[model samples]
Target: MSANTTSFKHVSYLWDEAEAAKLAGDEVALLIYRSNLLGADLRLTNYGGGNTSCKAMAKDPLTGKEVEIMWIKGSGGDIGTLKKSGLAALYVDRLRALRNIYRGIEHEDEMVELFNHCIYDLNSKAPSIDTPLHGFLPFKHIDHLHPDAAIAIAAAKDGEKITQELFGGTIGWVPWQKPGFDLGLQLKECLDKNPGIRGIMLGSHGLFTWGDTAYESYINTLEVIERCADYLEQNYGKKGPVFGGQKVQSLIKADRLSKAAEIAPILRGFCSSERSMVGHFTDDDRVLEFINSNDLDRLAPMGTSCPDHFLRTKISPLVLDLAKDEDLSDVKAVKEKLAPAFDAYRKMYTDYYNTCKHDNSPAIRDANPVIIIYPGVGMFSFSKDKQTARVAAEFYTNAINVMKGAEAVSEYTSLPRQEAFNIEYWLLEEAKLQRMPKPKALSGRVALITGSAGGIGKAIARKFVEEGACVILNDMNAERLAEAAEEFKKDFGKDAYATAELDVTNQPQIEVAMKAAALSFGGVDIIVNNAGLSISKSIEDHSQKDWDLLYDVLVKGQFLVTQAATAVMKKQGMGGDIINIVSKNALVSGPNNAGYGSAKAAQLHLSRLNAAELGADGIRVNVVNPDAVISDSNIWAGGWAEGRAKAYGITVDELPAYYAKRTLLNKIILPADIANACFALTGGLLSKSTGNMINVDGGVAMAFAR
Candidate 1:
């Protein structure tokens, strides 16, 4: 069957003979290998969307004999990255015994507790809820996947008929049943009735296939999906037009992306009424096709048929309807529709909970759509983090594929409302949600910081990321930015940090940096204006170039960054924070520091004016004054320490002690101390305080704000 699956139009086979040969004897490794292959392609399964299992013989510690055990992908684990530790190991004989004691489908959920008693390994992860399906089936190896192509057929009105038509008698069909002991029994019955079948199409669910070996089962799943996809493609092509043809023309690429960015923050604000949401935008051709199509109105509200798709995306997506000739660039027009659209969606979701929720159901979660389908642009997906938001978009695209395939061939069918509600608010699912760690201080926030390649700037960037903020680290040095980004990726993750080559003094570069923040993680919620240089010189020695360099990076840089970032803030209607990394020199008199001190004073005054101006927009401006953050400071690295020491009538080696003794507390300051003050201002601690300054200088009384 794998040999015949040489060239697949809709999906990749991805089975490697050399790779399989390495894990020939380790049944569990082969299972993981096969599962990864099936999960590698989105055409096969969405992220964390499917289960695979292998029934093998292992030596039993208690019995001192070989016993049949099942190794299956664990609950909440993705098959594509399935590790041995991620696999739940259970006694196959014990798992099968639970069927005998099952009261009926009405009390099938009780079986989950019974599964714990059958555990063969103490350290294995919790078994998936589909354990019954794998254990009840009389196969050595099994694959249950929510491949879009297979689901399209499973969700068709004539799904059962389509299964037989495509696979002849090689694959049987089971009626619609949610995953539980009862559905397991139904699958068992269908297989018992059909002699020598390759797999079964579980109605409004997914495809299940089995074989004697892991490779054979993997190949069978692929062959079944390929054939179903091929059949659907033929019928889809013969039927003409996706989603009943386009009703509106799509906006051009630049206009579309610009529009998506323009509306993204507004949508994010609306979705974040209960809690903040990071957003991801996609203008893929298929998404545009669906949104611009005539049938979009009819199909989007019907929701997704697959449980996996519905889980991440919510029960249904909110569609933003627009007229055929609506002006895509008129953001004001789109903005006006958004409030009513979101209000209606919230009301609908609330009604769904009221109608479907039981007394024991977990309290209603945030009643906002995870996915928003917009006309003229594309889709916007929102979640607690960038990665989750991206994954939500990916899952919705899978649903789009399913809808396209189903509608083209046969009628696309959504899951029954009650079933979807049941699955969404299921007690087991609620437990999983409850188990997740509490959100961090800056979760769902995006921060843009300049001069973040080193010193206090990079320190602040790292702290924001640690507190759950996605960051755009900006620097004039591209190499330094790349180096910092790699450190961030290594320490935290790639999704947590992005880099933009920016000279804060360059207005155009600052604008580009702001756009990078928007395009990477929705929009900016915080800005740290920390980029600067020291050009210390006496009145006689000061040059025009020295003054411009000091003022350009220190004073002008802050202004440009604030201007660009605040523009985005006002559009979001969510407000934001701007922190200026000022200096003790801003207030204290110093020698050989005329250019640097005046620029610092300018930065300080600009921050105060901004605080007063942007307060109406709910934007806060604050300042952090550090006396001598010499360690890891870019200013010090660029010969500022030597200049300051020479001016103080001391050597560079004694500069730290000299600055420390001048402070009331007699302590040298560090970058991390400055970073902490920044976090306190923006991390919700000083939420009500703005236009204020925090001294992280070990008590510089002379520089204290009066």
Candidate 2:
């Protein structure tokens, strides 16, 4: 169909000239506003997959002259949340002048170095590799994006003809060229030939739309995409084959959803590197639909929708069939099935790298597959961290949609395997890889911290994040849990932690929290059962309600959380640590504290029992007995600290000093001290110790174990 004859889909344009004029002189503000508007829709751009630029007149810092400056999206920042700092500005004339001295550069490292030398501002962040494309364009506003609908047409076998059919003479067409200075020159030449063209469809790459204003460029992008979407719908929407049929039914012999959860940890372990984390995402509906489809085998082996996704989702996905009648739940059986498949995949990837690599290419990334597909359950995307996994998930999801769209029109085709390899191991991408900070000691580890909103639990959560662990923070207080999550995000990045408001005593809640932890990260590796309370009362004065509450929180709560955490740990087949926050009173009795002390004693014994039972599974259980930790402790707020102070014949202000004097160190125990002991127990520093007690009570003589 031709552009004139095709009825295109209607899209809502988010442009407002009034809003654009509000920040007319401020280029960065205008860019941020328009970038956010375009980025808000995933159909236009996926996470970190697009770049936008504005050519603005600004006073050069060095020479007070009004120069044309190109402000483009910087690397390693999302367009949706882009700030002024996210853009790297360069002098347009100076940047363009590099074309004179630059010969056809073959190596990406040299190209990147040449590009970096063009930076007009030393303080600006590094610009995207596509910055040259933006600089070469004549228009004042330009946007380069990997819109799925646009990519559906761009990735087709007849993509150039498809581009002509959709946009006719208004948009120019450029064949796939590895993005660099030469490609930028080629794009400029294409636009120069078609001076009236409003956009460019980059075969096997993406789309570029440009105009004199941000609104104009954004509207042009939307109109072209809408036209493509409409063309796809008219040609393939009604004619496409229905997804469900006899093949889907045949593949559903056993429950795959449950099976997926069973196999996720195993898959995670196989994909994880010693230094990099491998987070898993198994609950996306698009992933489920794609994996469950009968055409998955045919579609998955096809290359990615665009070369840009190679860095995140890899060139293709790995498919595993878990539909056999054998016991799929057994870890050993799952591992046996996966071992051969993983070996085969690695061999294939290694062969591809060896055959396609050039002298300038970076070292091959780990041959492990980033995305995994199973017949019955769903697909899983893995990465070095949760945020990257989520990004890969989004890209893969969109990739599936693009493939489906392409299949409906015709057959889906990807960039050549050689081209994909070229992009995957390109020097520019390798530079970014090299810039990534070295992984911390606990980089791939996941930890669950109960009562993490405050006190020792919060401190431990902070320590875990600092050591490069993904933490799931749980607290009974909903408000405090949210606050703690915010604080954690502020301290670390948002991907470092997740929060669950949990009442640990309840079995159902505990189970849900455990699943959340598994889904948030891959599986639980370390658990801090720090959620507890205390009631100061004699055996006679401790009422039935008070005694039950103490037991429910201090003793039974640990039991429930431990049971849940251990189930995940066993499935993971990775040894883990479980540290119970008991009390110094557990080892030595104190008057008028029977309810708290007895419950703590029960918890200590529970730890010993767990250590014995779980030793076979490579899970260690230990206790951290902390006393007089009044600073920032919620346990001391419920009239317990005041009551203890009264027993010592002192005020609450003097109680800390009194307790310090009783211990040999004569130092008051702080929350941080307890956190340090917890870290020591679980941080692989004392890996050989289990069923052991570490005291943070300033060295009490009676509490010390013989």
Candidate 3:
């Protein structure tokens, strides 16, 4: 069971000489290299999924003592080729001190401050979320990787059996649990039990390994992978036609390049693999076989190698039978056929969730697969980085191997629906949500705001607090939503506001978050679909993505939240008010604002429709269109209003006046003006007026119809 007696041979390509050298001498270099090594294995780690650490000594500023310190990777840094500057040097003593505090701390801010006070780093990023775990480990050099092979065995249907066979007594296995303090605590116990253990495998997550020397740790990683691969080959021996495809290399190369273009703008700076080894492997039979496997349902219980792999590979890949002579060259045609296949996959996911989830759980995650393969065309994988891509592919590859082996053993079953939901929505796993303090908005009438975390959303949220209504601020940034909630509490006190980090476009999540918010608030009484985004570009410069994103938040998001709120409003029997933060574009014929204008118009209509349908239920809906709101926020801090002012032949200072002059009343509006209007609609002052568009634009009107 000792690391010395483990017979596994090293064959892992997870490290190079540069990394090995860093581990041997410089602790700083070792820390950076170890982080980069973990980052380079994305299939095994992703986005901000993994953590690594190295121990050293720091001269304490206050105590003037040489204190034991652990240099851990700062949060959100890419581990692959990580920089030395990316580390936060925390007092190992402080980290261990926190670990020894058996009484769980109630507030994370207290813990965060304690960490900040002790950790010395020029890096501004937060400490690695796994800092507590690093403190618990005794090794000098610790590495955590989301290795597909290792996680595959750990997440397998007979994961226990597979893990016992591969590492046997050499590794300690912990069942799937939320990472962070809890998992770290469990790991500490496991380590205590297996005192000589060289590594640990977290079920349904990734692998952790460490050693006295860097080479030994890296080599141990290689050895463990080789053992797993060998075990897969021996037990499953899955060979040939793992996938089916022909050499349509030229077509695939062009198609992949075009696909890369679609993703490039969003990914920003990651090195692309448009036609690299990754692209070639995905096109191979092994990947295809993994995707097209018939035993997906039975084997999926093993779980993904890690949760993030779901983002890349989806819950699983889709297998399709394309029609002969289908013109994939016609991009629209290809997209059309691909739609139904993905739809089928999504349907399967829903069925799985419904069958598996318990009554008391949030639903599963985004069902989009990480990889998709076309029989002759090729395969495609998505990730934030190359390491992520490789790790995901490896997971997909080995997941199939495990499933194939399981077919020979017994019926494969995934975690029950409730169990999976628990994992996905574990409070510790849902770090984003747990960080935000509960808003007092939960105690009174409900209020909904669109784009609730950005720009005017934050403003209106503040205003609603002033009006004594508990507000539900909706936004895409779950993290930002948490931060905003803190700000709201600080500004308006704890009872004033709550947030639903709900993507307005995704109706399901919106529904879920809304229901939760309503239940938390007792009932909803107000809604302001203030969620909107604007791209000041002419029609020719507008993209489908831009158009869709604008519409989804402005029109669709508003409509969905309104619908959910109206249902709750009717039951509450108390009158409710919905205010739409429509733009001047909705009333004015403006160039370079086609999408925002059109979506705002739709939003205005949706508002009117709500006014018409729900007015009988004691609910009123209205619109507030602001012409030019001079604000001190980021959106208006730059080229936006300046460009508009220039286009109108005026200086930036004269811009608000120029807009003001167009209105009968030469008044410059603030978000507070719109907020005042929303307050009026929600309060008793405007109960008589429903289905109205109250122009807050100081009498500006480019189109005077209706």
Specify the highest-TM-score model's number.
Answer: 1
Write down the RMSD of candidate 1 (Cα, Å).
Answer: 2.2
**Order by TM-score, highest first:** 1, 2, 3
Clashes of 2: 0
Q: What digit string (tens of lDDT, one per residue) describes model 2 on residues 602-693?
A: 99999999999999988999999998988888998978887787767789899888989999999999888887888888777788889999
Model 3, 1-706: lDDT tens digits are: 1233244442325456654664665776766765665566543355555677778776777778887888777765667756777677887776777755545633332455466766655454567557777778888888777665566576666777767666767877888765566567788899999889878888766788887765566666656766665665564434432222222332354453333322221111111212111121244555444444444323443454456455345555654455322343444454455567666766777776777665644546545445544444434444432344445655566455445433433223344445555455544445654564543221234577766675676777777776555677767778878888888778866545556778878888776665544333434556777766566677887889989888877887788878877655544445667888887678677767787788878887887888888877777888887667776343465466765765687788887778778888888787787777777666666668888877778876565546
Q: Write the per-residue lDDT of candidate 1 for residues 367-422, one digit (tens) a residue.
A: 99999887878888999999999999998998998899888778999998889999
Candidate 1 residue runs with Cα over 4 Å from true position: 1-6, 322-335, 657-668
Please report how far candidate 2 places residue 473 from its true position, in Å.
2.9
- List residue ranges in candidate 3 displaced over 4 A: 1-25, 35-49, 100-118, 122-124, 238-282, 296-305, 311-313, 316-321, 324-377, 380-706
The Cα RMSD in angstroms, rounded to one decimal, for candidate 3 relative to the true structure is 14.8
Clash counts per candidate, in order, are 0, 0, 24
User: For model 1, what is the alpha-carbon lDDT of residue 388?
Assistant: 94
Q: How does model 3 score by TM-score? A: 0.48
